[model samples]
Target: MDFRGQISAEFLLIVSFIVVIVLVFSSIAGPQSQENSIATAAREGATGAISEMSYTNVSMKPMRVTGIKITGGSNRVISISFERPVPPEYRALVINRTVESLLTVSGVKPVNSTTVRLGDRTYTVQI
Candidate 1:
């Protein structure tokens, strides 16, 4: 038996094992990272929409300041909640049109609903 050949084989095996471990770790982290990215995008879009939107105040003047919370989970489910001070009229419009436009999935559109639960380990994009 050539001891030199055995040593080379052992070193190669160790290196291959390390590479496999790294690959496994990365694969595990990939989906979570992707979810984070999605969250970031959602936040930015929602912020833009809210900033550009205005609701008429009691004085009948367009008011641009309001709280909008948009939460999107997996399976293309979105839940939009407005602050207590937001006007109901604008809330409906935002949920129906603006949010749907913002989160345009391939074959699905957002429907007005109150349910937010999707599944376990959901990635919630809140803004």
Candidate 2:
């Protein structure tokens, strides 16, 4: 047996092992990072909605609010809801995971019952 060849093989094994470990950890962290990002988006959207709602009050005149859908107005208050479709594999990780947040002129608040399913495995936000 050549000592030089054995040393090279051992080094390669160590490097491969490290790479495998890194890949596994990264895969686990990747989904967590994505979840955090989605949560942030939901919060921001809600705040924007509430801001628009507030403007309806400050306009001094009675603005005919026609539709239930909130529209951007002069007011900074807004309520926003967001939904993300989970992948088959991710569904197992987080079955029907939902997040809801409210934004008011005063501040932001997280409210219960923000996410709902319109159809099978499909989710939406209603504020």
Minimum summed lDDT over a 10-residue window in model 2 is located at 90-99
| Highest lDDT scorer | 1
Candidate 2: tens digits of C-alpha lDDT, residues 1-127:
6587888899999999999999999989975564344445545544444344445446422222122232222222223322432223422212122233322211223433443221122223433
* TM-score of every candidate relative to the true structure: 0.52, 0.47
Candidate 2's displacement at residue 67, Å, is: 26
Please identify model 2 stretches exceeding 4 Å from their true place: 59-123
TM-score leader: 1
Q: Which TM-score value belongs to model 2?
A: 0.47
**lDDT of candidate 1 at residue 21, scale 0 to 100:** 100
